[model samples]
Target: MTDVQPIVRLAARGDGVTADGRFAALAAIGDMVDFARDPPQVVPGPEHAPPPCRHFPVCGGCQLQHLTDTAYAEFAADRLRRVLPGLDPVIMAVALSPPRSRRRASLKALKRGNKLILGFHTEGTHKVVDVQQCEVIDARLFALLAPLRGLLSGVLADGQGAGVALTLTDTGIDLLLANVTADRLDRIEALLNFADAHDLARLSIEGPAGTETMVERRPPQLTMGGIAVTLPPAPFLQATPEGEAALVAAVLAGCEGAARVADLFCGLGTFALPLSRQAQVLAVDAAGPALAALNSAARMAGRRIDVQHRDLFRRPLTPAELAVLDAVVFDPPRAGAEAQARALAASVVPVVVAVSCNPNTFGRDAKILIEGGYRIEALWPVAQFRWSSHVELIARFVRPG
Candidate 1:
């Protein structure tokens, strides 16, 4: 809590409960997780940044923002090594994307009356802080913080125990003002006008089901790899354009001649389209909307891709159903694919590339594939989210006799 306290750190500190019932290693991540709330006021870095937001260290959003760039990446690389111990591949390169402006989703704390308050969770605990300025937010979205504060301040009689949620993308902003009733639609609509009046490209009002509806669901227009793509408020678009390309490049490097490839849990085909250059892609996801978006992107790019909607978790595509896939890019959610991991390892496919955000799950699943006679060929640890104790990694495991 204070600067004088010596740092108690863990090399592979984790979050969440582990099998032994301890938090997952917070320190052992490719991202930064400083145990101290307020970063030391005296630490040195580029003095050019817009002065540190008063909540810089107190807000749990970004860590190590004050650390020098070189120092930060080294801190990140250590976490990557601990996470993916089996590959032992040299880091090809650490691509530093420009600082963030592309956060599309955020949760807020809520309050009411003299007690009205809606913001982010406070440091160390689940309590919420009345966030005024978020350094991590984009210029467009960041500017709305105060206006949103004022909007909520007037609309809500009191927000003592409530909270709000938000979304920001290239297009505009979305504020999920909580605790709204159908009777209050008029006042809420007026709030949307206020957001629009502020030159917000677009705004949507979302809340508990019936009480919430999109005032404007203008999906953001974005282009990637020379292909135009659009996404509803949600879908896993890489938060930064540079990070997206870097990740795609990593996936593509491993995907050469990967004929009849299966893109698991594919969101918007970041990997699928590029891989399709010399291969046929079968993109699968449970979300119909995301699947639809993928198909459109493929079409817009003049590339052919087969999109399937299915819950890969409950049921992965049966091995018999798989085409003659020479290689596979399995990008599943954090809870790594135990069933599919085993299935792919057992399959006749020669290569399996896994892109994961969680290390423990990746390690366990990689262990599964390795047991099935697959050998780790390469490891690519990506530091996309630099401020949290989390990192994304891509690994290629080749099947063995």
Candidate 2:
């Protein structure tokens, strides 16, 4: 009889591991793995779940869909615990976004002889999986797939590929097609007709020449902190509305009494706009369009937010500049905010709210802050990307007064 290994935990990349260091893909915690088999077979455990999507293990969009909600939450929390081992900050309950809540997605499109395949690429491959049904994205967004297939069939050349970016804005769906030509009058007309028929908020196409806005029935917009801000084409947005709300709530709670705040990398004022309500916020970012949108929204709403267009990577705020602020909130990209974190560590700011999508970088940055006499007060793990390996978190750090 082969001795079965019980999967104890999940690795950073969503692979399950046994107590003795064996790894199994798609194996959930508490699952039993038979290592004797050519490819270890995983016996479903209490934590294992039937993946809701048919494309599981194939579609690169999701990885841990085989994990039950309880197991998924544990996976997210475990990621933080593994990354920030010694810090032992208060890890709040995981905030898991429900299915069919994703507001944005980037899909691949390919013209295969008489048919158009439109969906995410297969795991670690460029091959597009003609998605018949998707469980993660908004149903409204998924509903457009059929029409999009019909529309692109006429636009794309044989054996050609294109990129499709779909975003659910406040007004309606914002569509951007890349690497496709629409210079001809008929092709352009087809695109315009599709946008008008589907009531697209905005539509744009990108080719070797550049991006061109073919149609703008209505300006694409997104409401941040109760303020309506027109969005730039395919602007950065939190994956889901529920996830955005959770991050905002955590950041707000962390900087509860701050009178003056600096929102670093404040794209489209996700945190800055809300922070502006209670504090004088100085919002800074490198993206000009995001800053412009944020500035326009702030001015129209009569909010006290100073928007500055500066690349934090090249020139992070000096400690002296950050010293005046009571609290600082920085939400950088996946690379994390190493340079900015160093400056914040050296600053005399009382409170620092760090929002990160990568745990390893966040842990490194947290260590820098701790080394500078700052202690983490709380950390909230958010499963914004749902079943994917991606985990986002908002942590509060305080310098002992």
Candidate 3:
């Protein structure tokens, strides 16, 4: 083990106690190569657990597993505060119970020996975790885990190995065989027989290179917080039902009412279409297929959405266009947008809202907006990715010019 003390410091807690001048056991969210540059500390009091994955630090699948849930949230909130020290976020209630959330997830898979192991990526690596059961799966899917493992083992005992993920529902589960293709349907047919015999309820299996809708029959769509959203095949939607609703509510509460709005890095119009009813919105994203689905959904919802498939990174919103925008919101991927953040900061829109999955990047970009004459109004944290310690956030920025 390398000595991480020099770079590590204790974090601050509002109601939490500090020991020996340290904020407990905190990990500095600094540069990977140079850990000494700027590190965020983890609180030491809470008991930290190694994630269920064996490939913990090596694979980099779960970054914050070592932190206790309390410590983890504190670190997340602290990261935001450090970036924009003026804005201290009010931490909301965390969905601590499993099976109560996570309606769907697009999981990776792998076959080991004679068993199919199903779990997320191991730490930072591509290797799949050899999991007996996931702690953070849908409640219904949680029950099907053992039998499905057995079914895979029995059906393909002596055959070639592969991995599969299940989409949970109130009725049953939908299984997706990631590596299997139509060419191997004869063999897949055999597995389906075994699943039927074993009674793996409503298991719909498919391959990566399949037809228009790989799901065959569409999966259960969710109405998260007054928003009628459909789960189209493999688009990136939140796993948990409650978690998704909470996130959308937070974003909506930020954008009370505004006109000539823009949502950058919008995915499936998660925040865009819903907010459209309140304002004239333009949703821009790079994924052509996802944007198409969003357009279809918008049409179905009887809502007007200006969908544009453009790379928000390479071609960011110019100040000229920003000059007309009254409000802005974005649900960017893990790698937050530095370029778009800059543009939003320079925009004439007095109110700017940013939604991000990664805290470190959000912290970095929030610091930029703060310096650009924007005062952060409210910072809200949401723990949608539970058990994994991944924190999501939405911050409302106001430019008083």
C-alpha lDDT score of every prediction, in listed order: 0.64, 0.93, 0.62
**What tens digits encode model 1's per-residue C-alpha lDDT throughout 298-320?**
88677768888888888987666
Candidate 2 on 1-401: residue-level lDDT in tens?
69689999899999999999989999998999998887889999999999999988898999999999999998999999888877688999999999999999999999989999999988888888999988889999999999999999999999999999999998999999998888799999999999999999999998888779999999999888899999988889999999999999999999999999999999999999999889999999999989999999999999999999999999999999997899999999999999999998888999999999999999999999999989998999999899999999999999997
Error of 1 at 316 (Å): 1.5
Which sequence of candidate numbers ranks them by lDDT, best first? Answer: 2, 1, 3
TM-score of each: 0.80, 0.99, 0.75
Model 2: residue 69 alpha-carbon error in angstroms = 0.1
Task: Name the runs in model 1 displaced over 4 angstroms.
Answer: 1-10, 13-53, 114-118, 160-168, 173-182, 210-213, 300-302
Best-fitting candidate, scored by TM-score: 2
Candidate 3 similarity to native, TM-score: 0.75
True lDDT of residue 304, candidate 3: 62
Clashes of each: 19, 0, 23
TM-score of 2: 0.99
Report lDDT (Cα) of residue 93, candidate 3. 51
lDDT of 3: 0.62
Local lDDT at 318 for model 2: 99
State the lDDT of candidate 3 residue by residue for 1-401, as single tens digits.
Answer: 23233323324322122232333222432211222334543323334544654454444334555556665565655645565555665555543324336766555544567667655676446776655554556656666666666655544544445555565543345565544544466656766664565444344444454523233343434453244555444447766666666677777887887777888888777778778878878889998766777777787777767888899889888878878877888778888889988877776778888888777788888887888888887777776666444667788888887
